[model samples]
Target: MGVHTTNGIQGVSVSDDARNASARRGKKGLLIGSGVGVVALAAAAYVGACYHYKDAIPEGTTVAGKSIGGMTSEQATRQVLTLKHPNASTKANVTAGDQSFDLAPASAWKPDAEKTLDGVTEFSLSPGRLLDQINGGGEKIEPVYSVDKTALTTLVKKAAESKIDGAPKQGRVKFIGGKVSIVDGAPGHGVDEKKVADAIASGWPKKTDYTTELVEKNSDASDNAVQAFAEGDAKKAMSAPLEVSANGQSVTLTPAQVSDVISSTTGSDGKPAIKVDTEALLTTVLSRGDKMRVPAVDAKVVWKDGQPSVVEGRSGKEIDESKVAKIVGDALVGDHKATLAMKEQKPAVMAKDVNVEALPSTSMAHFESPFPTGPSQQARIHNITTAINRLNGIVVQPGEQFSLLRALGYEFTKESGYVEAGTLQGGLHLDGMGGGVSQVSTTMYNTAFFAGVQLDEHTAHAVYISRYPMGREATIWNPGIDNKWTNDTGKPILIKAHVESNKVVMDFYGTKKYDVATRTSGKYNIQSPKHRTVKNVKGCENTVGGGVPGFDVDVYRELKSGSTTVRTEKIHTKYKPDDIITCQN
Candidate 1:
């Protein structure tokens, strides 16, 4: 492994073989040294190149067209364009670099502060991908000869200009008639479309943030100065209280008290006179960000069924009805005018003792029938009254759900001795607590239909009943079938029901502006015969009925203006009679 060559004259004038070996050794050493020297030169050259470009254009200087101080024009320009650029644009904004630059013209040394470079403009590029390409020897100084900043800015501005502002803002507020309302917040005056196009070209207001804030008129400096110039007394609008009446008692407000109520209301312009919705104001005031609170006046509670009503200090009392009607009429004085909304409300907590005994005292007492006697008969009568009482004073908000079980807790049952009555497959039959309840449900359904509420889920009885108005009856099975509906009339609905003697009647009271009536027509579609066999049990008889064809019945309710049918709905009930079979003992 060792081949040693002595320096200079180590082996002079040797044998021919020794001379050849010496020449070979000298050649090998020369080749090794030449290769080593070449490698050293390459390392030194790499280090120098890195040093020359290290701070080429300085760290902060935008490199798109800036010059590097340490190198010649060609070298600096190459270095400037060699580094990678970052991506500032997003997918939704389109992938592009966000940082913009102004490049001096090829002949100019510095950029003009006020003018765009005639021949050059900066563009966005992906930082990660572009950097890889730059290191891999991609194009240096990408050309801007064909790029159009004006056109590109215009395109992006259209996509970015007040995108959220244009959309309606949603907020919850207390509305008139003692209800919580969700409505669109005031929309921003639309963007100056022409100005937007202009701003994009000029780059005005480079950064923007959009948000919502509760604006207080008195607290805002801008509002204070504007209020100073207003003509009417500011105190008058801010402090006025509205007048109200309930159950024969009337409350009148002094001018000073009225002003106090006014100040509590919200609106950039100032507080409004007349009726104000306190529920709406409370919700708005409690919301985060910007909000204000105003002291509310006293309110009265109007109750039904002798139930002690709940009076909310939170929600302001309703205004005088006569004044309300007059104001409404005045608002509609012209061909078309905004409605003067009312803030009317019934008692939230109805009077207690709303049982059957309490039914004889209220205004609904006039509709009660004589009480029943027999156990089964009395159960039926109690069922009807109990069902109706659940409806009494129950306020169904506009678009709210009305659940039958929710209305009737657990006061009914069959095991509790409300006998299993009715025919096996022909007449009205009872099973448990829900038995004989259909009559009451049907009555409610008819009343709702006539009142024009939205029926959610309704099912027809297995067999029709004579007491009900044809196919207008709603049948239900507890824990299985239930009748559901909603008040979609843009107003709340109040339900009241009572039973006296042999007659059970249900009534629905609501704001009336339309005349509605219902009638049932058409026969049940009797399809194939359905048979049913009843098992014999204690106090029960086994009976079998032959199958009968199914039938379709229609209940029609026509909303009217005098005699004209304004809106008509068809209540379709499909009846499938049970199968008939011979019974054997």
Candidate 2:
């Protein structure tokens, strides 16, 4: 029994040992598996971090719609760009640093004013493209490239060699006749390659061409039959013989070996060559003797319509109709003849009809005339006629100024025969011809005062005299000083003057459009006039009592609707004491 119990104990021990060994092996295997799993997880995490932190961008990396990864600069910039979402809310923030600018992205994006923004450079981004990048959507983006000195130099040289420098200049290629011509390197019109390329790059079209003139030279012929023959045309060649210098030497034409003269010909479009009909051309040249006279063109000047016209003058005389017809026919067929001949003739000249605008009849109180027609009846008539003719159809526009110098250009020339006389303070005077013409000027002033024209420039005489209404007369001198006025009334006015045997009258004509009426006020503050003397070939004499008393005169014009003075001007003329000069010869 004791032996049996020991064996049982040993067996129990063996079983426990086996079970512990198995547990130890299982535990070792589980620990190895756990260690392996932890290492694998760590390795995977490391690989993921490496991928996330990589410095080199891989292929197919992109922003907006453009490819940006591992691409050469040229390949990266292969897309056309346009401003996207023109109406999109966009705000540009331009940030400037010391040497560079950071033009921030637009809030959205839009095109700026084309004119203002043309040729401007800026660095910028588009927010719409950024949003698109975040959404994995296709994008539109403006691109930028570096433009340093080296790159610009290379680009310019390449462009010049290609399209600008060697390219045909605009309009320089002139195709006339049949040949292509170009005035090479004409400065102002020459080609500039850089400008052209920039225009093309900026979406502007290149200029094409310009128009220019072409000229050819031709002259009368030469001699030395051989020399003339070398010039080609025989007829024009022998028209004038060439004059050689005093040294006797004949100019030689053919050196025996020269055969190209017969083939010379020229056309603008065709190739230039020397071609001539030597046989027939020589005959024409020899037939013409010295002194080629261009036949006289028969013509006559006659009254056609109202103007003089030149025609075939041989009409009423011994005119050969066939000969005249032949001349005209040849003229029409000439190589260099004007196309429209009839229009070149001067047509007729006619006077315009006198048109007087009808107006309400005005009547002035006719009284016993105090003014008298003085001596020199012929002179008075001539002055009155001249003044009348000048005043005929004279028109005054409202607000337009009238100058006496312009009107009296007639009185200053030698044709009027007026001589130079000394001026008195500001008075008009003449020594010889048309001496009394100032009578017309005085008449015009009186009429204008009543007609109500604005007085602009006027001068008073140094001395006063008779034959003129004391202070109411106007005096004018030639080439120097005169009276002037403006047509201030809103109406056209005409001055008509007429002189008969003993009377001179001036009448103003115009529609009562402005309702203007003028009147002279009281003549007051009269001063005793003075005397003047003149010395001629004989002696001096003082004329007495003829000098009129100086007086103050007031003239006014009433602008009215019915019976009212809308505007009034007071013209005060205080005639200085008269110095009546008496001439004694």
Candidate 3:
């Protein structure tokens, strides 16, 4: 009986426990279902919101301060396009100095409605719109613009050009009619183009009228400034008589003369300055031949009896221009009596300072040529001797060039001490003044050639002369042909020439540097002489002038220092055939 009772109690307990477990399960299922229903409702709300605003701008969308929320992209674009922008017909007045220019505002900047609308459309599709639909905020779109920079710059430059003046001129001194005067400088005006351009670029659409003044630049010495500077000096210079004494000689400069030299000027430092015109003072008051103005004599090298001799130069005492001006200026203002400033002017070539020892002691090259003997030839010899005397003893310093024609004046008439003699004209020997001078030139050229001097200018004669070396002679004519040579011996050269018994000798005394060897390519390119007939009857003779054959030749000169050949030079010459003239009556 006890066992059965215990079993019944345990069974009842077990059944009760199972019922509690099932009730708990039922409660958990109900809570989960309720939560799922809440989630589904929230998702549906989000989807509905997205669908409602898909084709429309978010609620908070704004463009150019205009609200376009809840509108489609097309509607927003239209709204933005209708917004007010800068007017195209507006005009701006720009001023520079007294000039004014009307600028067309439309030309500088233009409003782009299509671009502005496109910007608004871009904003609508942006992720910020979604945030705007949720948070009720939007982007503020600005209007886009296009600018014509070149047109704007041109307009600004034009306005500046019309009113701009040239640059200022500095003051200077002027001497006119024995009077000292000061020329004043003038100021200039100019406009700043860049400033005007910048103003237009920044404030064009906002401001309609822009006015600017031209900048004024002051000159270095204005009228008032220069006048003040010269007033005291000029008054002092024109006050009383100025006296200057030098070397026991005295000269008194009247107030008028002093005033003539006193002037105002601008110095290198760009300041008003007082100056004295020394040239005017010297010309008006101090004569060049005055005892205080002895002329300076240059030293010279002369050939006396075929020997090089130096003529000592003499320095002359003269009034120093600058120092005299200062002393005189001070005297005019202070004491009214002053001694002139004296200075010794030294000769450019001083005897003692010259390198006479370096001069060539022995003759490096010598040339001698004989002339036809006759009374006419003697007259020609006289002229040639005169020219040689003029050139004798002339020293050619290293690197110095000598010109034969320039040394001998161009005019060969009797006034120039030249008598009629034999000359070549148009390939015919004729009597003319300065005819025998060719002999001198030919001798000098050969001498220079052997001396290794650099030949600068030289020309061969039209027809070869038997007296001169073949292919090595030169001729000179006034105003055209010239014989020139440079003294390249690195030492001074002394030229000595003499005429003796129908023969001329030219010698160059210089340091021997090179031995020159000349080679001649025998004459080529031979051309036959042409026969020319003449009708004059005075000296009727057949073949009055003999014909000469034409030919071309190349002469090569090789210069040698000791045994080594330093340089080789080629001189090419082409001679035309001499015409055979036949005289017939």
**Using lDDT as the measure, which candidate wins?**
3
Question: Ranking under TM-score, best-scoring first?
Answer: 3, 1, 2
lDDT, model 2: 0.39
| Residue lDDT tens for model 3, 1-585 | 123347456433345567788789878988998898889897776666665566555554555444555445544554444444446667777766676666565666654657765533332334455567656565666767666676676666554444355645556555444354676677765455567767777886778888887777556576776676556555555657777677767788777666677665555456665466677766655442245455455455775576666887677676787786677667766877878777886543467645565666799998898888876477778778877875676666544566786455444657668887777777665677787888888888889888887777899898766677768889987645789886655356678788878788888887766798988889898998898776754433354456888888888888898899878878888888877877667
lDDT by residue for model 2 over 61-117, one digit each (tens)?
A: 432322333222222232112223322233221111211111112221223323222
TM-score each candidate. 0.35, 0.33, 0.41
Q: Clash pairs of candidate 3?
A: none
Lowest summed lDDT window (length 10), candidate 1: 288-297
Q: Per-residue alpha-carbon lDDT of model 1 for 149-175, expressed as tens digits? A: 445444443443234233223222222
Candidate 3, superposed: residue stretches over 4 Å from native: 1-300, 303-308, 311-358, 534-545, 583-585
Give the Å error, residue 515, model 1. 2.4
Better of 1 and 2 by lDDT: 1
Worst 10 residues of 3 by lDDT: 119-128
| Ranking of candidates on lDDT, top first | 3, 1, 2
Q: Lowest-scoring 10 consecutive residues by lDDT in candidate 2? A: 341-350
Best candidate, TM-score: 3
